[model samples]
Each structure stands twice: as C-alpha cells, then as structure tokens.
Target: MGFIIKLLLTGAAAMLAAYVLPGVSIDGFLTALILALVLAVLNAIVRPILVFLTIPVTILTLGLFLLVINAVIILLADYLIAGFAVDGFIWALLFSLVLSVITAILDMIF
Candidate 1:
C-alpha cells in the first residue's frame, strides 16, 4: 500500500519535473505513472549493478557521480518509453534530482 503511494507520488514528481524543466517531457498522468514505475525498477535493479561497476568513479568523485548514474537511469527509461523524453544528459540529471527529492519529501509526509 505504501509502495503504491510512493509510486503515485513519484509519478507526480516526474510530471512536476516535466512542467518545471523544458527538456523533460511527460505525456500525462498515465504516462507519468508508467515512467515512475520504470524509474523505480531501474533504481532498484540496474542501480545496484551500476553502483558496483562504478565504485571506483563513485569513490573518485566522492559519491557525486551517483547523480550522473541517476541521470543515465532516467534517460534510459525515457528512451524505453514513448512520450517520455529527456532532452539532455544534464537536464536528465537535474530532473532526476528533483524527482528524488520530491519522492523523499512525499515519503516523509505520507
């Protein structure tokens, strides 16, 4: 139940990012929900492997590189889905950060 709420909140955050950032585009609520699910799965699945693979870079960058990884994951999701487009790498990174913060806040509030 809580996980479902989180997904909805995350989708709302993604939609919000699309509104805030010109480079990020979401079709609508349904599309946003799908994108949110993809992002969550990516963060859970691919993210761990990525963290392990990029451990050296993560260490070198003092964990800042994780932001880049987050962006990449978002971009990958955008590419995988229709009507969900992230324009640039940096834009993706910013969008990722905003969505993450929103989800965290929502999690706390709920």
Candidate 2:
C-alpha cells in the first residue's frame, strides 16, 4: 500500500539521518520505523495544538519558531522511544532538519 511505502521511506530517512549525525543515533531499522510512526502520530496530534498555542510567537518570529517546535517534537520522541537518542536540543534541531531534508529527497525519488 501507499501508506506502507511512505512509512518505509520515512524509516529509511530517519536511519540515514541518524547515521549522518553523530549526535543522533538509532538502534536499528525497526527502531527507525517505530520512530517514524511516533513522529507521524505526534505531528498529527500534538503539532497542531502546539502551532495553535504558539501562534503569537510564530507570527512574531515570521514562522521560524516552527523549527524550534519541530526540535521539541524530536525531543519528545527521544523521550518516548527507546533505542533512539539525541544528545541535546541542538542535536535534536539538527536531526529534525536533516530528517526533513532526507525525507523530502526520498519522497521525491519515490
């Protein structure tokens, strides 16, 4: 199914990002898949609420604050998932950015 393919792509991107970033690490492919799923769920549920609450700051920052929100979501995933570790907030921010770029590339290719 298309959904399954998308998840696999996301997992691959997560693994690749972790491999590229020393500050982030994922145990294995399965953990990457789980991480992808958790991120999707968090983005679906928590992200909107966060965006809504942070509207003023987001507006003030000209939408750049979304990057911080993305990093916070990554940190939340780090806390919720085992076998996945991000060294710090800066690492989380970098990882989120890398993951987004990798995922975008993968999506384009597939």
TM-score of each: 0.95, 0.98
Worst 10 residues of 1 by lDDT: 101-110
Candidate 2 per-residue lDDT, tens place, 8-103, comes to: 999999999999999999999999999999999999999999999999999999999999999999999999999999999999999999999999
TM for candidate 1 is 0.95
Clash pairs (backbone) in predicted model 1? none
Query: What lDDT is reached at residue 74 by model 1?
Result: 88
> Candidate 1 regions off by >4 Å?
none
lDDT for each candidate structure: 0.90, 0.97
Alpha-carbon error at 33 in model 1, in Å?
A: 0.4
Q: For candidate 2, what is the lDDT?
A: 0.97
